[model samples]
Target: MKLKVTGQNRGFSILVLVAACLLLLSACSSGGNGSNGAATSSQQSVANDATSGGSANEGAQSSEPVDIIWWHAMGGEMGRAVDDLVEQFNSSQEGVRVEAVFQGSYDELLNKMKASFGSNAVPAMVQMNEVSSRYMIDSGEIEPVQTFIDQEGYDLDKLEPNITGYYTFDGQLYAMPFNTSNPLLYYNKDMFAAAGLDPESPPQTFEEVYEAAKTLTKDSQTGIAIAISPWFTEQLFANQGALLVNNGNGREAPATESLLASEAGMKIMTWWKQMIDEKVALNLGRKTADTKKAFVAGQVGMIIDSTAGLKGIVDSVGNQFEVGTGFLPRPADGAPGGVVVGGGSLYILKDATAEQQQAAWEFMKFLAEPEQQAYWHIQTGYFPVTPLAYELDSVQQNMAEFPQFQTAVDQLHATTLNPATQGAVMGVFADARESVANAIEQVLTGAMEPEEALQKAAEEIQAQLERYNMTNG
Candidate 1:
């Protein structure tokens, strides 16, 4: 049977390598800070010994809690929220103890996973980035959450489909959606009104965005500032119902090609380049932080960024000017599409024993409960993956106060479910994103035309795909 939810209401606010990882977990566990750190072998032995050396009733009575390490990438305030959740789970029941260890950025964490693969010291649970799914699935080191869902007859109907869609591959759910977010068009209403544009009508298409930028460009303020990353390019493609990879975005089978040179891709690159040339759009380098700073400082009229930054941005903007939010700009003439989710999910590892695996599943289910999801959204800006969280009083109050929050949820629900929107999954996705970013830069700097740049990117990605499929085959 599942443990009951034990989270309390608060004021509307609320991995290491094998050897290196061992040191970190020992320190965390020793402190007894309730984060119960890594699953050290000695710790595992204690639990095992507790159940083995006594009478059946005595063994049952002396049942030691299963300890599981949760490797994560969230840091700063988000990292603290993670710690709080771990403590809550540790206190909620005696079945499992979760120790969450911050292991740097998503890329860094992925690198660490690669380094620790054969050591048998990998964590029992990991909060992996969305794009890392392809590689993780190929690694054969994870136990699909689908296994638990089927074993326990877990009903997935209560979870948000938009968030779950991205992790569902081969008719199986690979991970538990957590801390999900999407992109949003955030514009300064004051800037819009000053430009003689209707504040209520933010740009809805690329052309409209360009025109708005042109009108908003004057003095020190530009019309829009977007960090040129492959993510935005992917969003533009998905918004128009275009696939980034073949074979149903690798869901039907492992993808063999990247469609970065498709017509839709060309249009996106061309428009992005056109904006940079026209001087209305600010070509901030691939740091959304720089772009956000510009927007908050009132130097840019509009910007596009992850909904995960929604609360921070709004709070930073503070009473300086009103903020308006809209769906990520889509092509006016293209088929209906929607933005993809942009956060990590909790994954259970096969390195864990059966008991530890089930314990980890319980923790996953606890986090997905409506109350816990609402608390997560309240404590951090991450949108909830459980739709029922929206009905909670705290989340509703938050949405009412910051309608931009609602705009994000609405955009997600409004999206049409399709392979493109679910997004592309390829083993070298991280490398491919960098290649696409470089291709965009090449076009923006006039070193290559849109077609040539995208073609080059596609070729690089396809070549990598061939190698990855062969190696992992």
Candidate 2:
């Protein structure tokens, strides 16, 4: 394994950074309509063993209530839900008092954390995007939730395997998975019917999607509104059973290079370029918000977006059209792949007191409970990380009313676990996503051919990989 998260000592140097990438920024998550993850377990030692027997690790039993600061970056309805959860946790417990602080966006929060590293200003727990897994692992500022899991005897089985799989590394889980989401192919059912296509069936293959888009396109109305985002590209690569990086998606070992110029990448790039060239799809640049508005206004027939955006989009569309959700389109003749889990996870920071760490872990467990998970799933469009949440009345009722929200969960359940689906992890994911989006934009704008664009993107990402590894190596 490339990393280790073990030992009973509270705060040990798990990783040594050759250089600081503290100024490096990243976010691909919920509220942002996010990014899931995995990590390893090997012990240097277990000198100060903590909790046992499947209970909260109440960190040396403090005399005074432990005060812990939690930094999060969820805004609007999702932000309210987080505040509610935090309040519930705080009032429900007597030993720990949590002050939940809103930390702007993920990028801003990350930058703050980096800037505050090794300082007293860092919070006890932070909500981080899935893409930050590799960076977090290398930072040495986190206490692997695996430590708590080992001490508490937590049953991993009750949780969704796909989600756990993403966070589990070398038999150890890193961060506690929270607020999970995945991309979906959202189509206007009414538009489908008007176009003489079955409203119940959205296109399942790239070729089929193209044909459907072509048929749906008429004058100013395009079949789909596409935003040049790397999330969709990553989903497409997985959908076609391919990897975006080497070294088992930077698992098994740290990623040394990018695979953006591979056949899977080319196929997606070619398809994207072809759609624009044929005028069946509208390129709305890098902002998904723009494409989402176009779709909500019924200007576009279909779109691919995060499940986290489901409730807002549906509510916005209102009676204009019946919204339908479908699994992400794949290569018609290629091997079927799956979508990667997007969104953020809660991490226990090392700068915090042991009491604070224990409190944070307890809070994590509280959020993962079926009751809380169900409430969260409904409050935000993000699906529960645990399967038990699905059996609750809340989830069932919500699904019945807004059936479009069920597609992402259904799509996730049907996914076959593999490296492709587990997705990529890198310290420079923010820059990488931009590179991919820029490449697609260049192709669409005729600034460069698809082949040239992908090659340049690949090289740029490869450079990022080398820099990160060299700095953090």
Candidate 3:
């Protein structure tokens, strides 16, 4: 039942052209709204009405189906899965028809959404990355999911609290949890056995990981391989219960500066430098693909990555080496703080009509159903946002086939829903993340001292925060 509007070959180009037209139109219409301008009068009114207990679908039941547009960044197999779900939802309901549109990557989709803010071409629903929560909330182009939940008195008890916690700010959920994942340690079981290490007992702490890496390192195979990404740095800080920024990791109030110059951050960077210098860990630069390939090729004993990579890793390594998964290592000196969820969520745009919003909400709710969630989890290695989805027969079968997936589920259950694990919410989080990654690269490549690199990155983030707060506050 799903209609394909554009062919795969032309989809990206057409989307870019459409986005350009929208941006031009929006710019010509609005004098100086800029990209992060305040909500227009219409948007404000919509927000007010939604927050004041007004139903999105206020009109009486009509025979005409409400068509809603959904812009998502999913591509490849994930995109196909999304289309399948959209088809199912459209066929299952008579009152609503959801049109799913591919809008490139998360950054591209966000750019298009921002450009459409000044015009009326915004989608009824969009999938936004988790780190963009603050910017999305500030843009005022979104109606908080909590508003809809409160109006309908919907039951969200089935959803994972830790997954929901990331999108929750000011005691309210800003977006509906959709695709969620956490980092996990992937090791080569064959390499572990050859190194005289038990594949069943993976390292649980940073010190243990380092010791294991030393033992696993050999002539051709390095102990571990990790990409130079800020994500790993963020995870390490979270594991140590350390703040990445001030103001309770930007949950209590707008963060004014970065806190990456702290002892925990320094410790992680120092350890990373030592690992690379000692040849215990391969410096895979900034490309995750490189690290993944190295690990699958058995050139590295272990690697840390999101649980979402499990299926891909298994398929790539295929029959060559037994791949084992474990929870990401914690800090040696601190209490286990748990891993933060890294995925996108569904947001309803304010520019859409009441009926469109209602239809979008229905689609969101349908997608969150246990069956759909289980199917999504199975198709795309993303964690099921709802606990009930795990009980599904298909999900159980998948777990039986891939016991390594259970580690992710157990890790999620063990994670504490605290501020540290909730992750930092900053308007310029993407830039900040890049700055941290650059700092790590500098340290690993011996271009700069760890302290100097961290200090420079922290300063850069502080400036970005100041600039963002000036316009957003």
Candidate 4:
């Protein structure tokens, strides 16, 4: 009997949804959406001070309470977790009160943020997606986290390096890492055992994955289900020590063009095409929800998805079949590459009073603490940004109950810090990702060969990058 699994959106799709929301918001907020000059002036002063390494709190802690707004895109259980933490922070102190506001999804939140610029309604702090790091940094409206760290002399060593690495640029931490996640190979233990494969050891390389898929594909069940997403494709490239864009994956300097038609890119596209040709891997298009559904319904034996979906998959699978997880597969060469961090980070907006910024920093520090980090990890299945959170009793107990959760942590720890692993920082990343998805779809649907599809996509992306660089410059 197959387990009836309900589908959920993960990673790349969610980012796309956010981007769409941003567009919708921009359209809605056009015309008469007025600005507050006074607020904008105050914000500019505070931001200037912060950028100049001035203290976050020049004045003493006020006798009265300070209320600040935190706009976030988290929903469902994760939303509830945010509420709980806010309540804790409010109750724990009399100096600050944090108002947790849900501004739709990450895309919507960003949209609202853009619309709120130069207005008093702008949030004091906002949760921005990881992919938006480049845009956010270039926006010139954010007070880097390093400002607070340097001013307060906070201990930055407690945070996980891999998680922090994604938000760091030019040796400065631009944002506070939050709700970090990485991709993993999720498989069915029962299916593997029945296929005469060792359930204890999952495939670690692409070649092994292909052979296992061959044996696992038998009757109605496909061996693997993977969504044609830029996130997964990015991981494949990074694992092969390949650069997605020029200028050290956009870390050393601004990226001018994509390298999707390079040798490493060809290797990935070839493997994907071969898998679908052999009927071993199901072509799920760009819908991550469909891939999740296929895996849950036992229609496919394995999937390449983010660790963020672990809780939902476990809950949906129930007692039907045991779920197993392993690090994402690498190329046959076994190159020393690593996965990039997904999920969003917290950014303290510059359009706020110094008191509000200080209060926001307090809340930020609170969230990064071990206790809060552990609670968040246990509740939402996001990796704790701090290593100490893993040592917490709650995290340890949860890990024991669901050992699958440890795979992502292990993968993150093993990942070497490099430009490829840091991921591409481009202003037109959303468009670039969409283009890559389209290219993969073209290849899978037999409309174009891998080389042709990748080449076309890379050219389009390059054009967009040039336009963006011109405008932003």
lDDT per residue (tens digit) for residues 207-323 in model 3:
888999999998998999889889888988898888899999999999998999898889998888898999999998888889999998889999999888899999899999899
Q: How far is candidate 1 from the true structure (C-alpha RMSD, Å)?
A: 12.4
Which pairs in model 4 have colliding backbones? Answer: 18-107
lDDT of each residue in 137-211, candidate 4, tens digit only: 888888898998998798889999888989999999999998888899999999999999999899988889999
Candidate 4 CA-lDDT value: 0.86
Error of 4 at 444 (Å): 0.6
Candidate 2, residue 296: lDDT:
92
* Lowest summed lDDT window (length 10), candidate 2: 39-48
TM-score of 4: 0.87
Computed on alpha carbons, the lDDT of every model, listed in order, comes to: 0.85, 0.83, 0.86, 0.86
Error (Å) of candidate 3 at residue 29 is 27
Each model's TM-score, in the order given?
0.87, 0.87, 0.87, 0.87
TM-score: model 1 vs. ground truth: 0.87
Which clashing pairs does model 1 show? none
